[model samples]
Target chain A: MRTHSAIAEPGAIRWTLTAFAVAFLALFVALPVASVFLQAFEHGPGAYLAALTDPEALSAIRLTLVAAALSVPLNTVFGVTAAWLIAKYDFAGRGVLLTLIDLPFAVSPVIAGLIFVLLFGAHGLLGPLLSRHEVRVIFAVPGIVLATTFVTFPFVVREVLPILESQGSDQEEAAVTLGASGLTVFFRVTLPRIKWGLLYGVILCNARAMGEFGAVSVVSGHIRGETNTMPLHVEILYNEYNFVGAFAVASLLALLALATLLAKRLLGDGSHGGQGQPGASQEAR
Target chain B: MSVTVRNLTKRFTASAGSPRAPAVADASFEAPDGAITTLLGPSGSGKTTVLRAIAGLEQPDSGTILLDGVDCTAIPARRRGVGFVFQGYALFAHMSVRDNIAFGLQVRKMPRKEIAERVDELLSLVQLEGLGARYPKQLSGGQQQRVAFARALATRPRVLLLDEPFGALDAQVRVELRSWLQRLHAQTHVTTLLVTHDQEEALELSQHVVLMRAGRIEQVGTPHDLYDHPSTPFVASFIGGATVLRGRVEGTRAAIGPLSVAAPDGALEGAGLQAFVRPHDVRIARATDQSAVSLGKIEKLVRVGGFVKVELRLPSGEAMTVQMAKTELDALGVAEGDRVLVDLLAAKVFVEDYSI
Candidate 1:
């Protein structure tokens, strides 16, 4: 059987448009990312190594890793729970629930940080209670983690929702009929079916959690050794006229983004891996 | 185990202040032990819903599901000990045939050795012995269906439920799988209930047939009983390809478009009725024959495999279909636009005043 091409054969205008897109990506995205590594290594490998292992840089790396480690898994759990509730069952306010899950995506990250500050700041709502309890949330590691979680909240849920919705409830129903408990059905049947999409979501969530800048900056007090995350550390270094040091840390974030892209390619947009076809997996169920 | 359901009813509320008709309204039937009983109907006839309820996949608003004389209506699906095969096979695409078959046993935490042995046994039983290493996508449609059956049978539940198991396959594979299912049922003797909309499939594979219409059990009997002695006009027309003709009954006879046929027993006299006659029961002959009951013109002749379906229009403009052997049709030399006489060999008449 013959299939239609997704786009018609390239005319002069189409070729011109394609060339313009390629040039735009190269100039805006590729060059800037390339310059991060290029400028970081301009002082040679020794300086680059020194800048990476610098005390402040190391602490920022540790703080960023710690924040990502705390936030990604928490958001992943939330994402799966939210997706399961939204996709597997229907109830009143289902549409409203979906829109709420997507609220993080629509809200600006800086605004997300501001909202948290309003709740946890020294004089904001609940601030007095928190202060009375002698526990600090704003301008601390906890605040950084919370802000990062807020910014990356929608990644896993969005990725897993469509896959779960397409999968239907047949496999889970079959598992129940076959005498598998609810947990067993989820771990054995439901998890395996959505593993690729879930992984894709987690990868994106991890990327956002690691690279988050604006939100972490607002909540993180930028106390060098205590609460400075990688993005905040990069700002500190750049403002201190340590250009190579700043680019070196930025290089790591760029590498993380590259790794995420590589993982997405390997997973094939969550559609090609695993069963490769929605109907095929449905048939198996 | 013998499975019986009483007064199974399920209703879906479409939205606030608007309730849709029940999917299965007061459906009750008994599937005998160690026999294949088929719930047969068109889509939305509640056949699949009844099967799902028996499997405990769908909770009934009010019903008692008795399995081997035990009340299991409130039991959850996982504890009901019933194996359900979905219409689309529902195989785990990520698992090989062996692992797929072993899933149920593994879930029950059966010993590894025992799980392997049982998987192998099922693989051989389904005639998919060597293909156990292949993924579901690597196999053909028929192979995947067999794997699904094997997986469902792995746990050896008291009852096996199949919901249009062959509904996804093509014609040739559907026929092959139907016979395969029959053989499997015979060997297992596991008291199976199958749901299908195909009349021929239900007739060919089932020992007992439950005919359903609009969420109600229309009739329940053996395939032969349902086919030969349908209790309702729906059953009579649904079980076989029957042409329903509108007419008025006079005593024991029904007059339809210049022809008269014996009315079904208990049909009211002097009342408008619908006569249900199988296509093959409508005999056709040359119009010149004096023994002919009614005269009509052959509108079209459709050859379907070994038999030809003849479309005829009566003088009163009522359309009727007659099935005849190809050789018999050839011998009669009938063609489109030719006038012919049709004889109603057998018919079942019911009062047409009532709505289904």
Candidate 2:
């Protein structure tokens, strides 16, 4: 008697699924990205470079970098502390704390900006005190940074928490048993273990902070030279019907996204020079 | 340094508000200075919890731990001067073996040259001399365990705690590492508290064995004392291959299903007792032998290494096992289905109420 092999499906069925996936990715992702580069260079390289060097475009790039620089580090610190607290110990209302950390992911970015605006906007909560102190938050760089920080808050924590939890308390206890203090253990043992995941989170956070549009739009007031980030600048130029200028500046944001992807591929996958486990690469994702 | 734990107790509560039983309940034991003491028990026996409490890893609900006659229960694990080798080894995967061993000395802020020298010395001590540059994931399980041992010993801790140090290795590696651990213990002579469920490992490595059962210590004595004079049935059944036979006490003798055996001292009259007899102590002879107490049919014969194990069923339908040398079995010339007389030699009788 003959026995049937496992997974003895027809070859046509498998190829059909593979073809469908390829076609879907081409239509949704690759086409739009290719179109952006194609349109940006339509006016020739001279015109594209000229558009990018324009004063407003340069200021937008500078502002985007500044906002990302401020927000990513602040969020990174918060992320490590939050992940450490949530992962390392059992406490009351831990579920609620986790939900709060995840709040930004579930909330709409526009709504996130609105919440900050309601707290620090003119005629909003804390507005009277802020005005008395002569501090400007709404329609300023601070408001842009605030909105970007809120949206990117969960990335690092989300990446690092599961890694910490799975690694467990054994190594930390061993460190303590070896006469290491709490700070030394964190730096020498815990930090080195979770560094790859932490880097992966920070890269993604930096990318999102630079490209944030909806939340920054709600708060930036669109003051072109002062408050416009790269994503907001692309919108401003496009609204003025400067198509070449818009897509050119937009390509810079695309380049930032590509760089983020490249860095993630190098560091996040543990395929580069590192001793991190292959299992950790998936957690980095 | 000697270590003593007095009445350590710990309980884990379920999230649903039900209070579970204590993991360790009033468990107490002592590890003498310059000796190895093993906490021996099956899983859920709270042996590990006791070891952790002694290591300052777990906070006892109520107990005092004394290290070298100093009450150190409130001290944190870092300052307790105890080294623990976890069951999984818990080697830092990112660090090379040298850096892993150097971690404790580095944390103490030792001079750079001294730290390197100490790490080199430890690398040689655990016999992983040339492998210091390799990461933990590159080594075998036994090598990883040796690195963990080296790292724990780097601080020159007053006491060493090992939780099933060889639990993850194969049988041959386990035996090899057990002897390696014995030699290491002799050289260091740090008061060591080891927790293991393997009976043979505990009997072989420990100068004193503390037998635990269900969150309580059942007995604590030297290895020979616990093996030869087990105070309770759990100790007897747990330590060696002992077949239990229920019998009723008749004055100083216990009658077990058509066979009468001499009872242990202090067995009360007309009381139910359990006769714990090792397979080797159950002797077999021909039916014509006058000293035989009962006739049994040989049911099975299994040759195990240098000995033969004989399974027999008595006339009352109770089964018993007898182990003898292969030469003795050849002389007896008994085949399956043949009737033979059985004699009980050196059986210990315990009151059935004490049986767990």
Candidate 3:
């Protein structure tokens, strides 16, 4: 029904609160984002296009894409597996395991990078073993990918776990009793039910993987056009007082964030309906 | 195919840290080939768990499950040719009715052409022919349950396990599905095991009922047998409208507060014995019948569904209920607060002592 609450705020107070929120958004969000674009084109579109096409900028873009391509799919698998395990089955230490899945979220990203360094750096614990095995993880592309994955590890699990928990294993069990094998049941039943949430999680994880600077910087060894990811490259240009170049690259990252927000808003409708009453989507139609 | 469970015991490690209590303890039952047998019990009585154990959804700590005389306890659920209709229906939300029905067949690697044919057959079988392209969420609750039924039966599994099949439907829909299921059962005659807490459902739909109490099988017999002869106090109260009474057993006769009936077999002389009398069995006896009758004050009277119910209190304050036709109530001239001579036509007294 009639869903609005009986209680009502005074008109003056409601308008004041609405205006206050709009002002806050304008000050904190709209201003900086607009300024980034304005600054990027200060020397006109010609210089803006040149900065974007710079060899180093192009290399940074490729490196960011490569890292995301490597880390995102791997993290997706890990995320789905973790969420499925936590949601469907119970075992000893399950609470501990669930808490540990959010280890990335709770730990500082810098600390995440340092932990990898300690384990894989030249003078660290397993460094000698890795070097002897002809592995260069701490200051290489692999290291950069690992650190990015570490920072964004929890996004998919966080999104997918609640959906799995709410959806329950009923359909999966129904599939099993219908003589569908476990893997078949997962692909045919479980995956489709959580498809929207899984997509949302992947988008979030990819956005973070591309924009993460603290962790990737520690592991990238600051190699220009080599290991520098987009965020690291943006930092280098800003530090060198190349305002137009820095803002151009920063504008790209900002656009990516904006796209993520739009996609989230779109998928958010489906995700909420997925967890709603069964006839929700039909009623929406 | 026939289904048999032997000495099944499954203990859930309690979430509150107590891990030793078995949810289904030593439950054993047999569903004869091509018949509907129901496991009837209250919530937490473990009837559904026993059904799940049979479907290979839950592994019993100690049990042997036999399907058509073949031990299949060690088999996984996907390999066990038993289809289970979940309590929540669990229809695939993403797939259309056709694809949902075709899922099992496709998973079994049936040819594409045969799957389409089978899907069409099942859609019509469930009377959902034209709705093949509709998603589960697009269907009504009854239609969704029917789709679930069709999906489960698509592969023609040897045994079918239905966990509270109508538990999710509202009153009118439940009544309709009950008969629909009966007709389906008659047509297919697949060996079925239904688990439900509703006594009327179990009594009406199943040929045999296994009554459970506190994770133990209390009695197993035909519905008529459970109603006519209950072996325990739990069965007497659980099966139908049997009002249990506190009484004492002397020789072969049990004496309730204001009435007496023949004690159930082996009910030796004892106090605190319970006598079970159905509402219809206790009626207004003739005034001059010379029966040892005690007067009871009608405490409450209400008309319910083709019959009049009179809840009475004896001199000793023991309460009893008797239901009779409205004509009978009128002919006897009994109303609320009227004192009348009550007689027990049928009473079951268990020999094994149990608190009322």
Candidate 4:
């Protein structure tokens, strides 16, 4: 509420609060982001290019992209299936299923990494069986992917669940009565309704998959190129006092953050204008 | 399609383990081809459940759903070829009105050109000629409902099931759609099963009404049949404006205070009886009138549109609602607390005191 008295008016306080927020963001967020870019180009574009093109740096980038590539799609599929079942149906263990889906969010990323280690490490629960089959998981690229996937597993389901739960099953039932097959109903009606929230979840899941550190660090043996992802690669460069190389790779991650922000803006205004907002309450699909 | 259900019991799951859930018990009725049969009852009476069972959306625990004399209980909803308009319309929000109507046809892989012609025809038929490009949210509630109607009919299913389709609309809109639905039914002549708690909608829209109460099928008959000759007290009270009274009927001198009715046939002499009287059938007169049957005191007088509603408290302590013209009321010269006589012009009497 706006105060009537001039002595206690918001006119002065609004600007003061806005200035303080801007100053805080600039110092903590914008400054650090700018410094990373500035240091990446500290020795000019040639050095920045050299650092990025270094064989080990190139492999680290490849491994990070591959991990994200494998994990994001896998989680997106799992997330949609999970959200569909959890939101659309009622069963004895539905509450348990929802809580289990949120386990990734509740458990620390390091613990999530440890869970995979306990399952598939050399001395893990399945250690002997995995060795007998001549398969590797922990201390390998697969381990890094698994840890990344676990950390990012809940994003899509958490996002899509609320929208589906609110939208209700009326449309689906109507489609069924209209002679639409199960797959047809999902593709034509259900998917279009939930696509926006699903897309938002995918974006968040992909971002986390690309930038995960603690979980990937626990499982990744930091094999310089095979297992080390971008964050692990950055830590290695920093430990060796290779500031330029570290910041250069770190700038890539910062670039990803900027890209994600851009996507949010674009989707928020553009799709919400043309199509609609994600939520069922907004009547936007 | 002439849809029939035999020995039908409400069951949501096909798994044979638990005893039948007491939702709709032994609700067997036939919805004739080319006619609208309404399952009319209050909410929780399982009217919607019965309609869903017919649509194959719900599995009946111990019954056979016959569509055109073929057992369709095992068939899925899509294969059974039923069209359902949900209470909330359930139009695909993301799709344009055109796409919404075209969805059913497209699902069955109809030719593109034929689908276009069908959509155009439906748009015109539902009286929304140029609103096809608009999404469901952009359309008004009535328009969205019509779109759901047209979409349901687009495939020309064997039977159409409507579950309280006009429930979400305002009273005026519902009345408008009520007549509109009759016109559509007249034109299409589709076999339809409508589920609604609104007795007026059911009576006005359906040729047949299966009145249900507490998940039990009360009676099945035509609208006038159910209204004029309700088989049970529940039916009598549910079908129309009936004020039920408990009275005693003796040899020709019915002992219902404040009103007198000719002892209904077979009402046991000198025994308690349940009587249902319509509001318009009760006539109020001055206490000194010769034909006055019993004494009553006017408890309240309310001026409704085109009529004055008089609430009369009988000597039996039962209140009787009667509607009369203002002129008649003025002639009687009765107000609140005034003693008057009541003559029950018509009533349906039962031998058993069901009101008890």
lDDT at residue B17 of model 2 (Cα atoms): 56
User: What lDDT tens digits, residue by residue, belong to model 2 across residues A4-36?
Assistant: 479765678889998999999999999999889
**How well is each residue in A112-145 modelled by candidate 3, as lDDT tens digits?**
9999999999999999999999999987899999
- lDDT tens per residue, model 3, B133-183: 887877999999999899999999899899999998899999999999999
On a 0 to 100 scale, what is the lDDT of residue B120 in model 4? 99
User: Model 4 TM-score?
Assistant: 0.94
- Once fitted onto the true fold, the runs of candidate 2 whose alpha carbons sit more than 4 angstroms away are A1-22, A269-285, B289-293, B353-356
Q: Ten residues in a row with the worst lDDT in model 1 chain A? A: A276-285
- Rank ordering of all candidates by DockQ, starting from the highest: 2, 3, 1, 4
**DockQ score for candidate 4:** 0.53
Interface RMSD values, listed in order for every candidate: 3.1, 2.4, 2.8, 3.1
Off by over 4 Å in 3: A1-11, A266-285, B16-18, B265-267, B270-272, B285-293, B352-356
| CA lDDT, candidate 1, residue A144 | 93
Best by lDDT: 2
What's the residue-level lDDT of B115 in candidate 1?
Answer: 91
Regions of model 4 farther than 4 Å from truth: A1-9, A275-285, B11-21, B289-293, B353-356
- Model 2, CA-based lDDT: 0.89
Q: What is the TM-score of chain A alone in each candidate?
A: 0.90, 0.92, 0.91, 0.93
* Predicted candidate 2 versus true structure: per-residue lDDT over B138-213, tens digit per residue: 7999999999999999999999999999999999999999999999988888889899999899999988999999
State which docking tier applies to candidate 1: medium
Give lDDT tens digits, candidate 1, residues A1-285.
656588865478789989999999999999999999999999999999999999988999999999999998998899899899988777788889888888888988889899989999998998999999988999988899999988999998888888888878888888888888989888988887878778878888999898898888888888988899888999999999999999999998899889988987766644553644442343221
